[model samples]
Target chain A: MIKNKTGRIFEIIFYPLVSILIFLIIWDVGVKNSELSVVMPGPWEVVSKFIQSFAVPIGKYTMVYHILYSLMRVVPAYIVGSLAGIILGILMGWYPVINRILRPLYELIRPIPPIAWIPISIVWFGIGEGSKWFLIFLAAFVPITLNAYAGATTVDETLIKCSKMLGASDGQVFKTVVLPYSVPHIFTGLQVGLSTSWATVVAAEMIRSTEGVGWIIISSMDTNNVVQSLVGIMGIGVVGFILAIVMRKIEEVLCRWNRIET
Target chain B: MEQDRNLDIILKCENVSKKFQTKHRTKEVIGNINLEVRKNEFVVLFGPGQCGKTTMLNILSGLEKTTTGKVFLNDREVVEPGPDRGVVFQSISLYPWLTVMGNVEYGPKVRGINKKVRKEKAEYYIELVGLKGFENSYPNQISGGMKQRVGIARAYCNEPDVLFMDEPFSALDAQTRYLMQEEIMRIWEKEKRTVIFVTNNIEEALYLADRIILFTNCPTQIKKEYVIDLPRPRDYTSDDFLKLREEITENMAHTL
Candidate 1:
């Protein structure tokens, strides 16, 4: 059993490493042989440059600062948007009157993509951190609200009845049963919301930012530096992967009971 | 005897009838029926599968409303669900997010009982239902029979005036079903709360019930009543038990 577990772990690490090496080798050879090499640098050059950017500044700040600035915008907006969505969505799902009142207005806002609001957000909040935060907020808010609503509405009927039978008042039932049941669902919304907001941060920063992964790509485009553009994309990919893993770990902790051990 | 019966009656229903109205038709689920349950009596409502037995139990427990008629518990009309009446659902609806102790203590917890008091009450019932070591286990972590045990403990811990068990063991395997039957009997003997158990299983009805009320198919009404005087822990293979089972099965078959 011990040997098998070790073997499985080795297989997990070995296969992914092999796949990434193979991908990099193919890209390097392909770019060396192609006419596209003039515009696109080799994978080795892009990767080493991305690594070196951590210690050496790309423009005014290092890659670390670029990543931090992007995170600064995404984190606060995502947290606020998620909190608002969970509250509003759960209320809409639970109470018919709340749903009726908010649904029409929500539907109108939901269809407009966060990127579409870029021009108006710039007009309202100006070319500042406010406009960037607004765009990321919309991205996170939309998916989280829908998911939280789904969670609240889909609670088991028998469980609700059981709670009532157990002498729980209407409010008690909502707090104890409805809220706890919706948690797994809320986490699902959070996962989607987090990714959506992180993705939107690039567009949000496009409004006007000095140090961000988005600015690196936008600045690279002006200088026609393909290597820097690749570095920025790589930064986005690594951070997004880390964020998803962190969200999943938190969900596993909070929703331990939801996991059925077969 | 008649005066004592009237005085002992803890739950009574009068002219109970229910009809569900949809767009196309109004379907009668329960026809006119009346029942009187004496305190500490184990009354089983036995019928064919998919009959209105569960519906009857729901109406009596005040989980659902009757189209016409009234249900009285301790001389008070039961219009809505309350702590005085507990229900053990067929689905074994333990709060999935809550642990065994949490589910059991939920009744008192919601009713404003202190954490210490409710916890103590919950522990006693948990031990009573043979789930002492499983207090921390979630519903998904437990087996079906264990989940049902949690359901029973949850209802019992509430200290309701009566408990309505709607096909609680109908989902178990044959061996588990028999084991649960004996466990339920032992639990009932110790606690002796007024119980209204519903089941389509005839042998189970004979085994558990002091008084068995047989119900007909949908639009269900009382077809017959059996007063089983068998001794405690009656043997399933005993001549008396088999004889009673056969008699009841034949009588119930006629209702179809």
Candidate 2:
């Protein structure tokens, strides 16, 4: 088991680097050595342009500024939605009355894709930041609430009884047992919520935006710039990967006790 | 009033009977169990598997309601579970999310005890249970015996008048079970709290109990009782120990 764990640690360090190198090599060689280069730029040109856009202008804003704008849009909605989702989900799960009233409404909204909300969101809140935030909020809220609710609902009755035996009252049980018990579920929701926020933002920015990664795709298609479109996709890919890693690290720190299996 | 002030009688069960209602009929688990425990007494409720041992323990601890009787703790009727009757369940129910110290201190911390005092209290029990270095370790990081130790420490830290243990060490392997048995005896000698331990293991019952209450099978009642006058750390291989073990096993067989 120790050896296996050491091997896993080694794989964590080197495996992603090796796979990424192979992928880059394949893309560089295949694109450069093909007639496809007439319509599509080689990997080198797209990558260089992607890097240069950080300092130079892609359109109205540099890549960094565009990323900042997307972050600004996402962070607020994600925070608000996550807080609301966690509170509402835990409450609903604990109290039967809250569950009975809210469950139907939540279930109805849960299945609809965040992109589906774009038209209605735009109409309700207008084409400003409001609509985009609404879309992102919807993307984040459903999964967070669902997972938190699951965590709350599935709290081990044994643990609760144990706490009561140790002299905790109902409110004390909720604070100590119920809240801590639901945290892992809350983290699960956070991970899913983050990824969905990234996904929905692309769709959000696609619907009439000036300076974001999704705008790169939409504007590139208009101008027949496939290289720029590829660049937008790569940007999204890298950012999404980073976001996932960040969420995982945060979960590790917050749930250090929960990370290891019993 | 004078009789009511008998503080030495720590726990009393007055015709405590429990029944379950199945889909079609009423299922009785405990049939009119009347028992009393004095201060610092180590009572073992030894019974067969599938008997009402756990139900009886739960009823006594006030974790479950009796269908038609009452239990008194320190002369007060126990309608709800309180810190005064700490229970270590059969399944190791240590909160996986809390470290050893955290779990040990949980009872005190929840009861509004100040941090300094609770920490000291928890630390003392942690040391008593021989988990001194494992304070920072989570329940998952420890062995089964160690987890059971944490459960004991957690229960003891609450400073309960009586502790109810429902097969706390039954999940352990034979070697670990023996080791934990010795550890429990050592801790109990030091702490001197009233304990009601339930198990099907005759050797364990003979090894630990001040008095053993042999229980019958389904819809259970006390079949027989024996006072274990053997000294502390009673040798399992001793003639007296084996004799009692044999007699209890024979009696249980007859009753079953």
Candidate 3:
């Protein structure tokens, strides 16, 4: 078993390297032949620009500054939004009165895109970090809430009865039985929320921000420095990838029982 | 025989009936049944499918309400499920996310027992059920039989006045079921608690019970009650055992 696990890990590590190498080769070749302007520089150019910017001062349109700015807005919004979503979702799912009172309002609001909230957010909070934070929160909240509600509502009745038979009170059963059982579904919501938060950060920054990766990309566009803009985009992808990997690792650790074959 | 009268009554069901109302019709599951389980006695209820055996057990455990009549636990009315009557369900209902120890400790914890005492109680029951080494293992990490052991241990840890088993071993394979019956018998001998076991298997009923209550099909009523006079460590091949099995089987065959 130990040997099999080791072999699996080795395969996982090597397979990604092979794929990345193939992707890079294709990208390099395609960029060399394409008539697309320097505005859309190739993968290699973006990498070199990323390295060159890092050689300069820390806050001078560098990869670190833009990435940190984006993270600052996205992380807090994601945390607050997801926490609210989970609490509300569990309540809505567990109590019929809450579900009946809140579900229609949720449905009405959920259809409005997070980006579409820009004008209202700007009017409410002005074009500062708050507007961007609100957009990111809006993006992360709906899916997490909906998924959590579905998870909590569908808990097995047999399990609940089993808990009661063993002398668990309603509160005890909800805490030890229902909550833990709904974790996989909650984690699924978190994964969606995390990814969507990242997707919305750029749009949020594009609408209202002055110092995030999205703002940096916009400034690069104004200056017609396509390579820098491409570097910013690549940096966003890499950061998102890293965040996803971290979330997956946490998911595996917390939900070892729910593991399934890929 | 005189000692039978000395035995305390742990559970009593007086004219218990259950009617489930569905959208289409109100079907009576159990019709006016009277039963009693004496303290430390291993009582088994046997019947074929849809015979309301499970419904009776559910009423005993306070998982379902009786449409008529009353159930008394140690002379008090059974209004809701409590730790005084621990139940081992047919489906191994150990909490999936909790480790074996966590599941075992759940009862005591909910009963307002302190952490140290609950842990000790859980540990004792874990060892009692022969699952000492797998305390930290989650439900999915264990086999079906092992999971059932955890379920049994969890119920036993609560130290209930009566242990209500709803076909606890019926889901297991034949060999495992037989082994679990012996295990349960051993545990019962040591614990000396009243047990109300429900099953559909005739052999299982014969093998385990001091008294076997057989039930008829839908709107189930007790058809016959047999007081087994067989000695302990009963041999299945013995003439007396065969004759008793035949009697019970013949009695059950006519129920449909």
* DockQ of all models, two decimals each: 0.80, 0.72, 0.47
Ranking 1 against 2 by DockQ, winner: 1
lDDT of 1 by residue, B98-196 (tens): 899989999999999999999999999999999889999999988999999999999999999999999999899999999999999999888888999
Best by lDDT: 1
User: Ten consecutive residues with minimal summed lDDT in candidate 2 chain B?
Assistant: B1-10
* Alpha carbon deviation, residue A136, candidate 1 (Å): 0.3
* Better TM-score candidate (1, 2): 1
Error of 1 at A3 (Å): 10
lDDT of 1 by residue, A1-262 (tens): 2358879989869998899899999999999999979888999999999999999998899999999999999999999999999999999999989999999999999998899999999999999999999999999999899989999999999999998988999999999989998999999999999999999988888888888998899888889988999999999988998999999999998899997573
TM-score of chain A of each: 0.94, 0.92, 0.92
Candidate 3 per-residue C-alpha lDDT over B28-82 given as tens digits, one digit per residue, 9 for 90 to 100? 9999999988888889999987789888988988888999999999999998888
Per-residue CA lDDT of model 2 for A150-212, tens digit only, reads: 999999998999999999999999999999999999999999999899878889987679988
Q: What shift in Å separates residue A117 of candidate 2 from its native position after superposition?
A: 1.2
- TM-score, candidate 1, chain B alone: 0.96
TM-score of each: 0.96, 0.95, 0.94
Backbone clashes per model, in order? 0, 0, 0
Two-way TM-score contest, 1 vs 3, winner: 1
